[model samples]
Target: MEIDYSQIKVIGFDADDTLWVNETYFRDAEIAFGKLLSEYETINKIDQELFKMEMQNLGIYGYGVKAFMLSMVESAMEISNNNVSIKTIQAILDIGKDMINKPVELLDGVETVLSTLSKKYRLILATKGDLLDQERKLEKSGLTDYFHHIEVLSDKKEKNYSRLLNHLDIKPSEFLMIGNSLKSDVLPLINIKAHAIHVPFHTTWAHEQVTEKETNGKAYKTLSSLKEVLNLIH
Candidate 1:
């Protein structure tokens, strides 16, 4: 289980559930959304449809609350046969506004981990989703000073990481990524011959879930807490 960090020069971190509370808000929003459409469909059905709607609209709307807002609106229309009241539509928009306005809640040991890690290795924040929202959260989180570079990616596939590393003049061997989602943060780096660490959050979006077979032989470290990272990195 021993891995080398001696050659690692830059560390890329996924900003969502890894650093702050994110998926939980989305989960709460889904419950709110289900209630908004409760008269039209059951909560379980509404939840499934909303996820499907999001998957269908991901390419066009991208990620973040704005995208989820659109999906909710679309799903409402389809679920309600376009008869959703204007008042209900207004509530849906308000839901997104509330999400955007919510204060950033940093995870335990986040500041300490970043503060300690940034001393030696270069630290970069590489999160996926809307740039504006990510920027807003970073500003609110008061952790902006920790990063040398901050990027909001449309997606987090291997190609995206490759392009980012190349742009930063970082060889894959010298870069490491740390995050909650295996699909977005860990496997992509592993595939590209970079190191990654998995720090699982309590709630993961369905899209971020990966099969056991996909991770069966992946070379990455998993820690119970963000604080645990300090033990290995130094």
Candidate 2:
């Protein structure tokens, strides 16, 4: 089926994996965390429990490394029966700090794509994460000037997207979202009658993974690279 972008005046980009390296760091941190708690349980068990903890804590901690670090701490304590040492807890904090401090590495053709699209359309950043952390990354990325507006959302759901579009005075049909997460960036926008393009990253957080049933009959474009987006939009 053919999709139309002729009415799309505003384009929104997801920050994390869509524009730069993000989920990869979380994977690395998870591995380190597993090693730290290896004495309490097997690596596989630790990984599973940590993911469970993260899901349970999402509403409380929201998203970003700080939330993840707290989940790690909670999981460590639970798996160790509250016998985990302070040094290990400190190690978890250090892991998150290291992740936050890691340099932002933009994906291939990100700048070029943003630059090209900005010239032709209204580009806005619509990403969800810790405001300070997301702001820090945007500053570090050096791609801030390309966007007309930057929104760090608390969450990315149909309602959130609708609210954002309404605030921007944009109709759903006039907005397009580009991101890596099918759950956050693609499905929500599609639900609100907006256009979305999925650009999958190599590693994805378990929370962001969506089942086939959720995406059944969904109409969206999936491109292998950001460069391919130029073909779709204009």
Candidate 3:
């Protein structure tokens, strides 16, 4: 594939799995909390109740450490006959805080790739989730300098992409979104006639990974990793 860098101006990116590890951390915590919840109730019952609440509130709270921690608390209380203690709640909150303050680690080769792309395209981060949580991660990741603009939205859908394009004052055809999550990152961009390069992750968050097969889809391309983006764009 031939890429004309001159034809592209702004490049938008999804934050979580796109640039750094996100859901895996949450999954780990959930499993740990599951062990504790299982001591109080059946594992299957706990999982069902928690999953239902999470799916319901995904849009309202967005993705963040705090909201997830609270979801665990609610799930535990609901399943355990409302016998959850203050200590258990505190422990969950502590875990979430630790994740927030934890040192940010960039995905392998992310720094180098973004550094190369920044020089050629106007880099814009178009991540959608909790504002403060996403902001803290971006700041701590040491990647703030690599992007020209950072956007934190309540959601990433077709309308969000359209608004971003308008704010950038760039035509949809001139921008490209490079990230994981085909549903959120690629399909929305494709809807507006923009280019998208999907970098699939091994384990995607349940909310982010919705299977939609489109073999004949145009305006969107899929790859195995972010490193391939360098080849496609340059």
Candidate 4:
């Protein structure tokens, strides 16, 4: 079913995989680290241990390159019997820096969709991540101008979403949340009775993936690509 954009006064978007290639970069880094860890253990073992570290750290550090880099260092030490050297530490940090330094690659149809939708509705970039990292990416992507406000937050829980709704002076029905991660973007907004559009992305980061069993009905509508949103808007 196509949603009517006439009532959607504000459109909030999740920054990473929704608009640009995000988790793929982190996955590349993880695969690189897996190769490094393979020198000491089996590839499967490395994957299991890294996944464990990621789960443990997500509760502590949340998400971003910093948590990911530290998780890598800790995983290397644990798997290698605490034999981590300066080189290993440097290698982990290097991967983190690589992700930060990587060129921002806007996903297919993002520019066209955003540029088209911006003309009608108030566009807001609502993303959660490391502040500096997200800000740098927004500047580099050259798509920043389309947004009237950009929220760089460490978390996108119900409280933050509510605050943003109030800050924009918009009701839940008047806004639509467009994002990839159902856990971070869809669930919280749904809790507040907000409408959301889900654009399922390929290559989800380990931490952000939500299995089918967790989804709620009536809260979100999944789309194949963002271009669909443009079609809905205009």
Candidate 5:
């Protein structure tokens, strides 16, 4: 079906893994964390425990490296029976810092796509993460000027996107969201009767994975890369 986007007045973009490299760092952190506690548990166990910790702390920490850092600390404490060395704990903190300080490596065609789309429609960044961290990354990304508004959301759900529509003074049909996560970026918008485009990243977080049944009959387009969006919208 040709989903008409001529009525779309606003386009919401997810930041991490969509605009720049994100999950890769978290994956790297996990690997580093596993090595730190190699003596405590197997790598597989550490991975499972760390993910469980992140999920448990999601409500309290929301989403971001800071939260992930805390989860890592807590998991380390538990995995090591609270006997993990201070130096190892310090190493985990350092891993988070290194991730924060890492350069904002923009995805391929991100700038070209954003610059071209910005001239045609109202482009906004609707992402979920630590506000300060997101803001800092935006400042570093050099693509901040391409967006008119930046919303660091607590979560990406129907109500959240609906509030965004109300704030933009647009109906659901007039708003289109694009991102890599089907769970967070696509399904919610589709459920709310809004348009969404899925741009699958190389690696998806386990939390963002959706069952085939969840997307069985949804009306949306999935593109291999953000570059293809221009061809679709144009």
Candidate 6:
């Protein structure tokens, strides 16, 4: 279905995978984590249990590398039956630090897209993660000047987006969200009567995956790259 962008006055972008490489590092860290715990369980089992632990602790630790690191430590202890070595725990911390400190690599056309879109509409970053970590990445990304506002949400549920839009004094019909996660970025906006465009990244965390049933009849546009967003909104 064709949608209208004529009413869009504020365009919000998801920071992590949508603007730069994020989940890839997390995947690499997960592989390293599985390798560290290989003695306790198979790599596959370790990966599964780690995901389970992350889901369980999401409420307590929230999102981002720090929370992920805590989940890794807890999962390792449980997997090893409290027999995990201190050395291995140290390795987990090292893995998270490595991820946190990795260079911020922007995806293709990110700067150009932001630069062009910012000139046309008020641009805001709407993303969820560790506040310090997200701020660090934004500082490193060199794209901070393009945004009119930056919001680091705790979660991207329907209520969260509604509250943010309301706080910003933006009407739902006048807001557009662009991101990779259909669950967090697209569906919620669509549910709240806001516009959304999906830009799929090569990798997505398991927690962000959603069932098709939840997306049935959802009205939104999906693009292959951030560059294509210009075609829709302009």
lDDT of 2 by residue, 1-234 (tens): 689889999999999999999999999999999999998899999999999999899999999989999999999999999999999999999999999999999999999999899998999999998999999999999999999999999999999999999999999999999999999999999999999999999888888999999999999999999999998887
Q: After superposing candidate 5 on the true structure, give the runs of residues whose Cα lies further than 4 Å from its correct spot.
A: none
Tell me each candidate's TM-score: 0.99, 0.98, 0.92, 0.93, 0.99, 0.99
Residue-level lDDT of model 4, residues 1-234, one tens digit each, is 555546778999998988888888887887899888777998888888988998898878877888888889999999999887788779888999999899998988999888888988889999987888889999999998999999987788889999989988999888889999888888888789787888988877666777777783544678899898776666
Residues 1-234, model 3: lDDT tens digits: 543445778888888888998877877787778777777877777777877888877766666787787788888788777888888878878778877877777787788889999998889998877788888899889999999999997778889889888987989889988888888888888788788888887787776766456424455677877887887776
Q: For residues 127-180, could you state the per-residue lDDT of candidate 6 as single tens digits? A: 999999999999999999999999999999999999999899999999999999
Residue 137 lDDT, candidate 6, scale 0-100: 98
List where candidate 3 sits over 4 angstroms from the true fold: 1-6, 214-219
Task: Write model 1 residue lDDT over 5-40, tens digit each, in one string.
Answer: 889999999999999999999999999999999998
Show where candidate 6 strays beyond 4 Å: none
Better of 2 and 3 by TM-score: 2
> How far off is residue 149 in model 6, in Å?
0.6
The sequence of per-residue lDDT tens digits that candidate 5 reaches over residues 41-71 is 9999999999999999999999999999999
As a TM-score, model 5 comes out at 0.99
Q: Is candidate 4 or candidate 6 better by TM-score?
A: 6
Better of 3 and 5 by TM-score: 5
Give RMSD to native, each candidate: 0.6, 0.8, 2.0, 1.7, 0.7, 0.6
lDDT of each: 0.95, 0.95, 0.81, 0.85, 0.95, 0.96
Q: What's model 1's TM-score?
A: 0.99
